[model samples]
Target chain A: MRNIEVCFSPELIHLHELQGKIVVVVDIFRATSTMIAALANGIEEISTFSDLEECREMKDQGYLIAGERNGQTVEGFDLGNSPVAFLKKDYSGQKLAMTTTNGTLAISKSSAADEILIGAFPNLSATITYLQKQKKDVLIHCAGWKGRFNLEDSLYAGALVKSLESSHEADEDGALAMKSLFEKEGHQMKAYLSKASHAKRLQNHGIEADIDFCLTLDLYELVGKVENEKVRAI
Target chain B: MRNIEVCFSPELIHLHELQGKIVVVVDIFRATSTMIAALANGIEEISTFSDLEECREMKDQGYLIAGERNGQTVEGFDLGNSPVAFLKKDYSGQKLAMTTTNGTLAISKSSAADEILIGAFPNLSATITYLQKQKKDVLIHCAGWKGRFNLEDSLYAGALVKSLESSHEADEDGALAMKSLFEKEGHQMKAYLSKASHAKRLQNHGIEADIDFCLTLDLYELVGKVENEKVRAI
Candidate 1:
């Protein structure tokens, strides 16, 4: 059996060896969830940038510049980090240039991995199936809020580990703890995640609808893969 | 109400501002547990060092050198990281110089905090009462295994948060997740921790008794406070 490990935040990513492992970057509050939704809803490709100015400049190249900082859409960007917003309309034949407070930063730091996959509740089963087929060690890198731990991404990690338990042994205590957490709270994810700091932050912004949409599991049957810094549904 | 946050690993310490928070450093599997046991059983003070050589040299200054590396006792140490060993004898008036693979490193890194207190299951109530009296913003620093998240310390964090829930607010998602974990598994902690990687490592060293001893709740009614790098019961 292969091994599964969880790095609770991008800050803890240095403790993990990314090479030869499948790194699943998750920002369940928005970023990765939006990427999966955008790709699954007919967006051609998603290119991630860490700098807001850099991401906004993509509009000049005929790209739909999408980015958010601190949960609000950056001025002049086409969209904010909302998975539900991405599903509102079809963008077939269009490319997305994206950045966010946490998600894109995590993706940028995950370049050394053998493969990078975007993970969130939207593509849970699809990502599981993809990892099972690859048969490599998996590392779930959570895009916690500003280098601190967050609940949504960690709960997603637990969900992945629970589904992959039979095929992958937990490589550390973080994995085991997350697996137990999923087992305890998986059935009531919406209620449990409502207590998360990010959830409250979004609620303060009157975006409770987005939080609910992001927590809906297995909404898409496609997996988001990152190649050469661009994400596409596979 | 004061806020309670958890830093799941020493590596994540930089994400937190420790200058004003009351930092509670925990290594539940042994380090802090043993420190609590030692102080409760009458050891005058415990001085911690991260380097084994630096800790070992304390023997020349009439201090009892107790240290461990990788779950095993280093050569020329008086004791391994065992709470049970400390409880077996009265070490009244004796000073202890100690080092461990994870715990001491966490304590050393927490110097910027308003105060540092050693936390473990054995002194759970004492520490809780102490923190409640202090009424400061609290940060639980888990001395995770090799700068990675560990179940035992994080579980202890959950226990503290749960007990302090009435008077403290969860500051971050890590604290919230840990509170849920402790609520789900606190009653059966011994059985639950049996699955932890550090627990397995200890079992491999034929120290199953140590694990049980470390998990025993409220065995001591004193808190270990670090003042000028020397830990003493206050």
Candidate 2:
């Protein structure tokens, strides 16, 4: 039986046994959603960097830069951290350098994993289909808000676990708790998530549309995989 | 309105802004349950120590010692960690020195709080009454298994939040997730907890009855307050 565990926040990245596991890095509020949208909108490949200077350096090398820190777009970047910004944009053979407060940091820390998949509501079904094919122990790593647990990522993690067809055991209390929360609130996700701290934080910044778009399920059929410090459509 | 938060594990203690908050330390599997039982059975005060050597020194000073590491009773200690061990004991004016792998360590780390209260299912009603009287922002600090999240303590934290009748808001996602878990599974707590990892660990040691006793609600009418390294009925 494949064991499924959900790491509720980036703070728990160190506690997880990531080696040999199929890690699904989730930042449903924006990062992973933007990647999914970018890939679907024809961005060739997205290079993820944890450092702003590294992303900037890649931007200087003729790559489109997209990132955010504390919910604000990085200065001089070509695009902000909104999935809507990537929509309808065409860059068939170009590269996009990306960074974010939580998602990329989670990806960098999870480099020990055998495989890494980017997960968000927009790519939910595709991610689940991919995981069902792999049949490995799944670890949903939620990129919470700045080292603290956030609702949206965990809710998406729970949604992923709930959609899996295989029999699995929760590795810890966090996993069980997330599954229960997902089971309880899954049907009312949009309404429930409106009360989430990060959602409120983003809404306060006049970005409520981003929250609605991120919560939309299966907007892309592409599954993002990490290769050579970048996320490419697999 | 008071803001209530539940730190699901010691990993989250630092993430929370615990200053000036009334922190309720919960270790429902045994430690806090034993403290409630000890105080209910007439022990004057229990001095909590995080160090094994400190607990040993107090034992030499004629205080009855009780502690466990890796779920086993400490060698040369007067009692094991089972709450039932404290029952029917008479030490009306005597002190007990205590330590445990998770519980005391959580208490030691949460010294920055405005006030600290020892919480367990056995003292559920009393704890609720005490918190209701205080009217401060509450932070339920769960002493999870060795710094990782565990089920029982989080469940008890949920129960505490569920019991409070005051107008309160969850400070973060962890608190809201826990409260939802409690609301969904509160009625079937014993059966639900039987599947917890710590429950299996304790059951392997042939202490399943301890689990039942620990899950018992309101067996004691005492609320424990920590002062000068000791827990006293308050």
- Classified by CAPRI criteria, candidate 2 counts as medium
What does the lDDT read for residue B39 in candidate 1?
Answer: 96
The TM-score of candidate 1 is 0.96
lDDT, candidate 2, residue A118? Answer: 93
* Model 2 agreement with the true structure over B27-89: per-residue lDDT tens digits: 887888889889988889998877888888997788989877666788888887888877756
Best by TM-score: 1
Native contacts present in each candidate (fraction): 0.78, 0.48
lDDT for each residue of candidate 2 in A1-234, tens digit (9 for 90 to 100): 788887867777787799989999988878898888889888888988778888889977889998776667888888888898777567777889987768888888889999999998888998889888886888988888777777888788778777773566764566777777789888888788766565677788877778788889888888999887788998
Candidate with best DockQ: 1
Candidate 1 chain A: minimum summed lDDT over ten consecutive residues — where? A193-202
**Runs off by more than 4 Å, candidate 1:** B70-72
**Candidate 1 lDDT, tens digit per residue, A83-171?**
78887888998999987767888998889999999998977998999999997999999999888888888999999999998899985
Clash pairs (backbone) in predicted model 2 = none
Deviating ranges (above 4 Å) for candidate 2 = none
